[model samples]
Target: MSLFLEYVKIKIKDFFSYRFTLFLFLLIDIIYIISLSVPFLIIYSATEGFPNWNIYELFFFTTTGIITSTLIFTFAIVIGLDITDKIKDGSFDLLLLKPVNIYYHMLIQSLDLRNFFPDFPLFLIILIILYPLVGILFSWINLFYFILIIFISCLIFIGFSGIFISFSFFVPHFDSFWDLFFSFREISRKPIDIYKNKFIVLFLTFVFPFALWNYYPASILMGKIDTSIVPSLVLMAIIFLAIGFFSLKYGLKHYKSANG
Candidate 1:
């Protein structure tokens, strides 16, 4: 925790050093987040939105996506990218020799405090806006489940990212991998039920499991589904996490230092 705090302090100082750049990026992020809501508004304005989902519900769903993606980008993807770079330059060899557990160390060291600052305020704004529309559904137990699912979803995303980062141990140049992963992640932004094709829905639900990111949890929180599914979600996270762990270990076994 001390090490993590030290890294956070460094990041805070560095972020403040370039206040203009920080604000510029923050503005860009906010704009991008607003842009994501445009499609839903346009669709709803043109026609009835997304079968049963109202505009506010759709916005809620989008907010959850923003939360999940923002956290994943800050915690998982950034660290994975750093790990990839270190692997390419052979600096990962030194990272392994550090006294701390490699996973915890990399996670803390790669913490981009900037990427996390926007989500809380944005979420609060959304909650305030949504309270009138769907506030009746809110309860402490439901909120707890919602938060728990989001936490597991973040871990699942991190594990999925780990599976991709493991490939860095083999290939020297795989920078486009993150783009490919994000491209798939885009599927999680919308509800799977919107797709007419059963096969595609099943594929996403089971093969890729992107639905866990927002759909399942959002559905439960919104009272569209039963909470009994929480156990299943936890199991799925465990499966993915275990797969990611072994994949990383396998890649490590094959890794050859750049110095060699």
Candidate 2:
């Protein structure tokens, strides 16, 4: 944790050194996140709300998705994209020499401060705005579940992105996997319950598990499901993380260094 904090401090210093660029990026991040919610706002205002979902509930769902996506972008996809370049340049092997846990080192060192900032703070602000509407339902238990869900969501995201990142070890030019990954993750923008097809719902829930990133957690907070389901969710997250870890390890074994 201290190592992570040190990296964060460095990233903060570097970002602050260029105040104007930081401001511009922050502005862009805010605009991009807010733009995603605009469509939901339009839909809610224009039509009757979805059967079980009210506007606030849908807003919470959207906010969770944005947070999940942004956290993934900052932590995993960016590092995965960088890994391809590092492999091509024969710098990927350097990670093996680092004293820290390789996965932890990769994630901490790849901290992209700009990608994280305004989006996170913006979400907090949105939640603050939502408090008046949701305050009564915001029990300590709900907050605990929400935090747990977010932690698992991030793990699931990293695990999925790791699969793509692992390809870089075998194929140095595999950066396009991030684009494919992003396209799939965009499905999280809506709750799976809105879909009518059972198979599609199952696929989204388990195969890609995009629903975990937003819908399941949001539903839990909205009291649509019992907390007993959390254990299963935790187990699922671990499974995904294990798969991603092994995939990357397998790729490493197959890797032929660019320098060699």
Candidate 3:
């Protein structure tokens, strides 16, 4: 844990050490979030609003999606790429020999210190604005559950990436997995119900479990989710994490130094 903390501290120091990089990232995140909101703004203006949703409601929805995406990207996609890059350069071989668990080694090294500045501030700002309008119970217990759900979503995504990472050990062409992952991620960016397709909704919500990232939890606040569905989502997350763990263990046996 100390070594991991050192990695985090170094990332934080580096983020502040370079003022210009920090500003650029800050600008990019702001612009990206603003631009992405345009479609929702247009829909709100044209139709007045979606049924049971208003401009501010949609704003909260999209903002929450952005925060979830950023958090997942920081932990999963970013770390997955770091693993890929290290594998390509054969640097991962040294890390594999370390006393640390390879999973933890991969997870901690991929931390993107730069993204925290942009994503977290925006998350807080949106959260503060939407708290009153979210229509939840608004108690400390509720708040804790909400935060826990989002954290679980991050675990689900990291599990997904960990499973994807396992492929590199067997498959020569593995980078394309990122594209497939992103395409799947696009589905979770909005309320899964908006699709209007019952099969897709059920599959995503139950089978693939992408909705664990935002939809299921967001629906809890919207007063739309079924109480019975909550435990199932958490169970799905645990299952995926286990799959990722066993996959890595199996994959490691076949791993050879990239140089060899």
Candidate 4:
């Protein structure tokens, strides 16, 4: 645990050492937030309401989705870059020599605080907007569901990222992989409810599992779906997490040192 903490500390120090780079990344994130929110705001205003949803409900659902999307994006960029760079430069060898698990080491090395400043404000703004509708007093049950949704969302995204990054073992060029991954992010940003087919929803929620991140919880909270989906989401997260871990392990076994 101490070693993991040390790795996280080192990662923070390294990120801060390039202050200008950090600022640029944060600036880009802020721009992205505005770009994302503006469309939803415009559409909501133009329509006078979200289809099948009132103003307050739309605000709450959009906010929740944005928060989860932001967190996923943050982790994906941090973890993806760390893995890609290490594999490219062969620095991953140094990490493998450590007593700690290599995946854990990679995760710790990817930790960055820069994402918080931009994302947290957006998250808080959403919360403030929703407070009037949901009331200041939160039910413990709702809180539990909220936290669980966030946790599952993070796990599902990071797990998918891990699976993507592990492809470095087979594919020497990760630039294309990253491009593809980011393309998928665009789809994730919107509520999956836009897809009308029940089969598509089932595939996204049960198979890909990204829908569990924000959509499932938001649907339940907004009274669009049943609370029963919560347990299923948890199960899907665990299954995908396991699949990701196994994929990484398999990739490691096949990994040939760059020198070879």
lDDT of each: 0.76, 0.75, 0.73, 0.70
State every prediction's TM-score relative to the real structure. 0.88, 0.86, 0.89, 0.79
Off by over 4 Å in 4: 6-30, 74-77, 97-100, 133-138
Per model, how many backbone clashes are there? 0, 0, 0, 0
Candidate 3 per-residue lDDT, tens place, 21-138, comes to: 8788878877887787888788777886566666666666677677776787787778877777676667878787889887787777677866667677777697678867765565
Report the C-alpha lDDT of model 1 over 1-260, residue by residue, as the tens digit.
88678878888788779979777877887788678888888988898779767777777777776776678778777888888887877788887888988778777766676767656566658756875786445678877887888888777777876887788887668767777766776776788788778986776666676776677767778887779878877887888889888998788777777521
Per-residue CA lDDT of model 2 for 157-260, tens digit only, reads 67876787677776656776667656766766777777777986777777877777788777787777778868877998899899889998887777778531
Ranking by TM-score: 3, 1, 2, 4
Instruction: Give the least accurate 10-residue stretch of model 3, judged by summed lDDT.
Output: 136-145
The TM-score, computed over Cα atoms with residue i paired to residue i, of candidate 2 is 0.86
Q: Residue 50 of candidate 2: its Cα lDDT? A: 74
Give per-residue lDDT, candidate 1, residue 118: 56
lDDT of 3 at 77: 70
* Global local distance difference test of model 3: 0.73
Write the residue-wise lDDT of candidate 4 on 66-117 in tens digits.
6776677667657766777778878878878889877677777666656654
Worst 10 residues of 2 by lDDT: 127-136
- Candidate number that wins on TM-score, 1 or 3: 3
| CA deviation > 4 Å runs, candidate 2 | 1-3, 88-90, 93-101, 134-136, 258-260
